[model samples]
Target: MTEAKAHIVAAVAQLIDEHGPAAVTTRAVAQAAGVQAPTIYRLFGDKGGLLDAVAEHALATYVSGKTVAEEGDPMAALKAGWDTHIGFGLANAAVFGRLTDPARGADSPAAAAGLEVLRARVRRVAATGRLCVSERRAVELIHAAGTGAVLTLLAMAPENRDLGLADAMYDAVLQSIVTDAPVRTADGPVAAAVAFRTVVPDLPMLTDTERALMAEWLDRAAGA
Candidate 1:
């Protein structure tokens, strides 16, 4: 985006931080950004377009600053990503709400990026042979748990918020995803299916056609 566009988004985001989403009128944002209301329309097309731009800007900025411990354990990296996600939600409630809101979420580029990050982390875990569920299933479960935990926490007053809820949710998701090993172990039948499915294409004993068919069977068996 151009510097002018960035300035306008920044001004609107600041207003959201100061007075919540309801206060972000075009006139208010234009005044704060030192631009006229027509400029916002000319640049963003409409209020909804402007709000979408703001949500994209906020999510992209947050994701750009996040780093997981890639040199160490994948689980640890996943945990770091989880903590970062929760922190971003709490720090930017309006943006988080906009990203997760059913009306807008399907079209939100940031939400898709966030999910892609989660999928990458889950794939790392699956690579270690420690994932007890299909990578796709694990990603879904973790994403759902984290999003629900953040929204739940946001619903309460700051002083009244139960911080443990996030940890507990993480624990629950971890139990469902990981096996009982320091790093690599297949724990159950479903997990076996999930793990085997991940490498089915490379199974030397099976022909290409056989591998393809086996993958379909394992995917179903893995609940994916």
Candidate 2:
């Protein structure tokens, strides 16, 4: 994306994050981005288009920041992936909610990309010999559990949003899975290696440029 387009998308994301999706008007985005409203319409087509763009941009941004080294133990990779997933959710709660909202449509490219990330993580876990048995089922369960935990946190406290709650929920879910796994061991390092091998490959892959852009985004998100 061009600098201009990226700015507009970032502006829209910020608007939605601060004021909810309902507040994401072209005029508002234009004003925030320091561009004309007509430019937004010309580039994005309509509000729906702009919304889709925002969603896509957000997902791409989120996926880019996630880093799991190829050489790490499987269990460590899984923990890192889980941490990144929940951290992104907690850091961008409103954006996270917008992606999952039914209003966005399940078939939307943004939603598909989001699901792809989860599926990729599952696949990575299966690549490790530790989860050789029932790998498919295990991946599916992990994805389901993670999603459920996030949604449950949101549902439980509609009025009070807490980043800690998201972390706690995901930690519990991950702990449960790790504890029950056949490969789990009493040794922390060994357990992490097992988890890392099982979960790292299941994540989305991004090019170097995408990763740099995502890193910039996370820096901005932190400062915001």
Candidate 3:
């Protein structure tokens, strides 16, 4: 981005921090950025565009500070990711609200990226035979839980917020998505089915058509 574009994004972010999303007007941002209204228009098209830029920039900045755990328990890593997500939302409420907004949702690039990261983490859990559901299902459940937790906290006044709510929500989501151990006991069939589905595309012994058919059957077997 050009220096001017960066300036405008930063200025808009400051306005959001000082006030809120509703306070971000073109006139206010233009004045704060020391740029004319038309410059913002020319650079960002409009206030909506400017806010999008701010959200993307702010999210990326927050994500940069996150440390990806290279070695440890997969479930532990997943919990770390969850904690980072909650921290980001609490620290950047306006940007997080925009991300969780029904209309904006995954339409925002950052939100989509975040989901992909969560999917990869869920895949790691599935690979370990701990996932009780298909990888996709687990990801959706975890995402929904995390988003709901953050939004629920944000909706309450700070002192009134139940700090344990987020942890409880995570536990509930994890219980739904994972087994106490590797699915080697009574749930063996479900775990095997899910683990096999993840490797379906890599099965060179079978033709694409055969692999696809096998995947369909596995999908049913996994109850996905």
Candidate 4:
């Protein structure tokens, strides 16, 4: 993004932060950004488009600055990611709401990025032979649980909120999708398939067709 666009987005975000989403008019953002209202329209198309940009900018910026634990422990990194998702949702309620809205969410780059992050974390856990489910399933479960937890908490009065709810939901999700290192670790054959799936492309002595076929088989096994 250009400096001018960044400045406008930052200004709009600040306006929403200080005055709430309902108060953010094009004129207000224009005044705040020291630009004409038409500039916002010219750049963003309309108010909805502008709001979309703000949501994208907020999540992208937050994710860029977020730090997870140092490498080597994928579980720790996954836990950190869960915590970060919950914290981000609670802290940026408006942007979170915007991103989660059915109409906007389908087209939301921010929401997609968030899911991609979860996918990567789940893939790492799978690669470590710790995940019990397919990466896709794990991502869906965790994402749904996290979003539900945040929404549940957001629905309550702040003082009346149960701060432990998020953690509790996470624990439940982990119990459902994570293994405790049973006799067959990595959630058994399905998890093994998932772990192996990651390396299918790099397996030596395999033609492109063979690698593609192997990946397809692994995907079926993992999804089983």
Candidate 5:
């Protein structure tokens, strides 16, 4: 994208972040971007189009920043990917909300981008030889659990919408799915953690190295 278009998109995102999606208006975006309102309409067609572009840009930027772990031990990579996914969501709450909100379904390019990311992750796991042909269902289950955990965490405590909370939720849900084990579903952090472990047993325990990588990825993703 050109610098001008990128700036416009970033301005729109900032507006949404500061004022929520309902506050986003063509005139407001154009003013924030130092452009004329007609320019926005001419380039994006409508307010929905601008929102869609922002969502798509955010998703593409986020997914592009991810490292996808290494080429070996798909399980390890899968765990790493889960961590990355949750971390991105926590760090970009406004953008994540805009992408996942069902009300935005008609214009949500981010949702489609997210599904593509999921499908690609599944394909990678399937290629690892760790899963049998009959285990495709397991892969799907794990993916669903991972996403579910993230959404659950966001819903439960908007305040705990940080990387730590995201990691705990993902780990709990992940363990449940992978171990076929029962997990607590109480209304606390402990319950969230347990749910994560139940769904994703192989969820990376995380390390300083991994955290450092995540920080780097976030820096790149935020265009900083």
Candidate 6:
């Protein structure tokens, strides 16, 4: 990004943080960035484009601070990520609301990157043989739960919020997706299939097609 574009995006993001998404008019942003409103139009095309840039900026920062635990308990790492996600949403309500909008977020690379972070965490659990469903299913469950938790909490007055709601949602998701202990292939095909699915690409001497075929079969067996 050019220095001037960076300056404009930062200015608009501050406007969002200070006022609200509704306050992010071209006039306001232009005033904030000390440029003509047409400069914003020239640089960003329009308000949606400006907001998209801001979303990418915000999610990039948010995703960077996130760490999928490298050691110790993978579940613990996932829970930490959950907390971070909720905290950011509550703290950045205006921007979070905009980014969560289906129309805008559907095409967002940063939003997709955010999902990949969740997928990595799910993959870690699967690799540990603790996932009781397909990795795709586990990721979907956690993502839907997390998004619901944030939106539910945001809908309420902060003082009226159920402080335990987010934790309860996490527990519910865990119940559906995680096993208390690793399951052996003899005990169940689902968890074992999920576990092996993580390593199928690395399996020795397999052609790409072979790996793909195995993955398809495993995905079906795991009920994704």
lDDT of each: 0.83, 0.62, 0.83, 0.83, 0.61, 0.87
> Of the candidates shown, which would achieve the greatest TM-score relative to the real structure?
6
TM-score of 2: 0.61
TM-score of candidate 5 relative to the true fold: 0.60
Q: Which digits, one per residue and each the tens of the lDDT, describe model 6 over residues 115-135?
A: 999999999999988898999
Query: RMSD to the native, candidate 4?
Result: 2.2
Candidate 3: which pairs clash?
none
Write the residue-wise lDDT of candidate 4 on 1-224 in tens digits.
77888899999899888988997898888999999988888888999888888989999887776554437788888888888888898889988888888886477665677777788788778777667777888999999999899999989998999979999999999988777653253338876787888778888899999999999898898784
Q: Candidate 4 lDDT (Cα, whole model)?
A: 0.83
Tens-place lDDT digits, model 2, residues 53-119? 7777887877766554557566666756766766666566666776777776666564456556655
lDDT score, candidate 5, position 37: 89
lDDT of 1 at 90: 90
**What value does the lDDT take at residue 80 in candidate 4?**
87
Tens-digit lDDT track for model 5 on 14-120?
98888877778877887899999888888888887787788779888877675554367656676777777777766676666667667766454545565566555
Give the TM-score comparing model 4 with the true structure, all chains together: 0.90
- How much is the lDDT of residue 122 in candidate 6? 91
TM-score of each: 0.85, 0.61, 0.88, 0.90, 0.60, 0.94
Model 1 CA deviation exceeding 4 Å by range = 67-70, 182-187, 199-214
Q: Show pairs that collide, candidate 6.
A: none
In candidate 6, stretches whose alpha carbon ends up further than 4 angstroms from where it belongs are none
How much is the lDDT of residue 69 in candidate 1? 48
